[model samples]
Target: MVVVDVQNDFCEGGALAVAGGAAVAEGITRYLREHRAAYDVVAATQDWHIDPGPHFSDHPDFVTSWPVHCVAGTPGAELHPGLDTTGIDELFHKGEYADGYSGFEAHACGTGDAGAASSAASSAAGRPRDLARWLTDHGIEAIDVVGIATDHCVRATALDGARAGFAVTVLTDLTAGVAPDATERALAELADAGVTITDSGTPS
Candidate 1:
């Protein structure tokens, strides 16, 4: 399972606050608890922007660029408190200096620390790998995705997963979108990409 950008900056009271973000965080934790055994491994992805050039905007238009958020090591970049990541085996951090939106763009870092760099000294396997590399190394060919901003990061991650030849499924109930219409369009795009659009109740 892949949890995408369930960080504080994406939730309520956050720099980029998505409505229902807090609810999605809690829902993901609950779903993980009751269905932990359904998947062999679980991982999470976080946006960890540093400089990111024009990705941060003073007069943000809300697309392509956004208000400064998920700055490295800041509380806003940390995972949401409502999310229980005890079952997560690894974490992938992305966008240290760019507009990265896909979990596939992330690199695995050892768990416990939020926004840890992909170049961290080690991971569960003693070396960091991009999401696709890590998953492939673990023999993972299919993935279930859930998390914040269904129209953005969530959508990107699922699409990339499919393109990488990993069967992908997005649990709609466990995600919050930046906008309703965008979310609807994202789901449609995912379905068209051959990604399974389903709910948490659907078995992996």
Candidate 2:
């Protein structure tokens, strides 16, 4: 499955915008056009948050707190208009609470509750309707991931996919970096975790 976070808040001029974020959507569309029937499914993840969620406040772990972004019902939360989402079968929303950097721990997984079942289910749920679970549920194992902001959501989803036992391949050309440095770090981390990173021009 191809997970694209082409949300307005991550694109240029929006809250928490990433550099060169807009271009990722074009790359993803191109890839999908070429590989539409090669895979059984295609999905996207959206950072759908509500105002005053925990992520807005300053936290010591982060360099600085970000302004309200990806708020529900706001323009910033919508997917980029340029993306052709016709083939996408699912839209998973994450970050309903403060500090929602990872799509794997979104409210869809029941991460907010403290019960043991919730925690187990959260862990089992992996990323919100993640590629691995979707594949396994349908008796598949391979997945190709493509999306925006390689440094954060993309990286987290890829890494978690590998850990969840899916044969994960990240399409490098279909992704944009949050920053050069963070992108480099995420690539290193993903490589160390056994993810196969390849350019879009290469065969999956």
Worst 10 residues of 2 by lDDT: 106-115
Q: Write candidate 1's Cα lDDT for 1-204 as tens digits.
A: 999999999999999999999998899888888999989888999999989999999998887889999999999999999999898888889999888899998887656333354345345457668889878877899999999889999999999999999999999999999989999999999999999998887332
Question: What global local distance difference test value does model 2 have?
Answer: 0.70
Q: Each model's TM-score?
A: 0.91, 0.79
lDDT per residue (tens digit) for residues 1-204 in model 2: 756578888888878777667777766777778888888876677777765354586542223356677887789988887577777765666766554555554433222222345346557756334434545655668778877778878898888778878888988877888678878999989989999988879342
User: Which pairs clash in model 2?
Assistant: 54-98, 55-98, 104-127
Q: What lDDT score goes with residue 27 in model 2?
A: 64
Task: Give me the runs in candidate 2 sitting further than 4 Å from their true place.
Answer: 51-54, 58-64, 106-132, 202-204
TM-score of 2: 0.79
How many clashes (backbone N, Cα, C below 3 Å) per candidate?
0, 3
Candidate No. with top TM-score: 1
